[model samples]
Target: MKTGGVLLQQKTKKNINITIRNLTISDITHQYCNWLNDKETNKYLESRFTEWNMQSLLDYYHQKNKSELMLAIIEDDTGTHVGNVKVSAIDKNHHRAEIGIIIGDKNLWGKGIATTAIGIVAEYCFDVLDIHKLTAGAYAENLASINAFISNGFIVEGQRKEHVLTPSGWSDVVLLGKIKSQE
Candidate 1:
């Protein structure tokens, strides 16, 4: 598991300063577990299928920390852990990876935190990790997530019709991608 160290920082348009850091086991708490189990928060997330408890969450953290970059989004002003951004499915030989994000704090929604976090992490993937391409997918109804990636220069690459099963029935998935600038 990666130690908890601030990896990136940026200021959102709303003037909220946030930082991204390697998530540690200690970061897992009852509140964090609640965020995952919350219906509205995890609606578009695959994790919604599973019930999340502290033990299960810890197990997940252990598994993901091994192969992917699991980052925590922290509100710098109040020093609170607000959410997470994951860079997973990393194909080193192909220089590509998939990015996923969740802003668990409902009160913090629509504050440009997702957009800013995605931007910072995308920069790290391209410049620091030497990843050539980054991809993300969102449920068709998840305009907030799609727009967040779009705001950071990701283009909608394609859409998979009826790609995922949801509570409301099958839903389309919007695929978005961004290539590292050559310059």
Candidate 2:
């Protein structure tokens, strides 16, 4: 599904306006690649395990775009490509999908951009894609990520203790889920 135009918009708690659109290959820039390579930016992300470059990022975008709904989060006032939100692992038979997000711009962290982006993508998954359930997982220590999902109505479904190995030590994986209301 190509979401080229403005899919949704929301003013973050910081009053920063943002919108999301499908992430095209053209959106994969050197700066975008750098985000994946940044230590702080990818700390909780599996991408931190890999050294990313332009070609690698482009290949990833091409691969994911084939099966997932990848979107770019844009800062409206500046029109900056600040981040990405992805709806992946779509199980059509079960009407469920996994949602993942990364606010690449460190400057925008804690600005409610992630929360607003998750809310927009969750709505698209339920209303546009006809998905009944949306799920996400975050590193136990990543409170910002967990809170972002929670702010969008995702509930804590379960936790897998010491599920992932981090630089510091093993960390739990917090699983969260949200089911569409039966209106």
Candidate 3:
């Protein structure tokens, strides 16, 4: 657990050798920028509505916010950066945060990496950060994300009617959340 400096915490899954660590300046690469620009990848993301550029990415990486934690998902075997997971909008007083994940590697989609990372981050939120609950929202049509959250113990808490406007028209957003187990 690298708790000080830029790194917050580290987690590695033995089954897939996938590691999650604090996102650093060095991790801001062209591939990541491309992911943000890729329509297919960003279709369901709110950021898809914005144009992405190197400068914007640099600014994003440099921005400081105490209430959010962004992490990079790495494939330990090949040293490949696969995706990102973010726990943001943290309300420390309320012990809660909003979580989101983006697995940029299309090849790695459908794998259980997102689920594993979500579980690890949720545990970190509860056991390390002392957060009481975690929340996430996904487009109603994003079954993969919904399934990943559910498989990681999140439950559908509610739905926002036509929360987002897509090219296909308005789409609902499913709200999901999980509370730290009182053990």
Candidate with best TM-score: 1
Prediction 3 TM-score vs. true:
0.91
Ordered from best to worst lDDT, the candidate numbers read: 1, 2, 3
Residues 55-79 of candidate 3: C-alpha lDDT, one tens digit per residue = 8887877773334688888987898
Best lDDT among the predictions, by candidate number: 1
The TM-scores of all predictions, comma-separated, are 0.96, 0.96, 0.91
Give the lowest summed-lDDT range of ten residues in model 1.
Answer: 1-10
Q: For model 1, how does the per-residue alpha-carbon lDDT over 1-183 read when each residue is reduced to its tens digit?
A: 122345799999999999999998888998899999999999999989889999999999999998989999999999999999999999978999999999999999999999999999998888788899999999999999999999999999999999999999999999999999998
What overall lDDT goes with each candidate model?
Answer: 0.93, 0.90, 0.84
Error of 1 at 35 (Å): 0.7
Cα TM-score of candidate 2: 0.96
Which ranges in model 2 have alpha carbons more than 4 Å from their true place? 1-6
Per-residue lDDT of model 2, residues 1-183, tens digit only: 333344688898899999888787778999999999999989899999999999999889889887888899999999999999988998878999999999999998988999988988898888888899999999999999999999999999999999999999999999999999898
Tell how far residue 92 is off in model 3, in angstroms.
1.1
In Å, residue 52's CA in model 3 sits off its true spot by 1.1
Give stretches of model 1 more than 4 Å off. 1-6
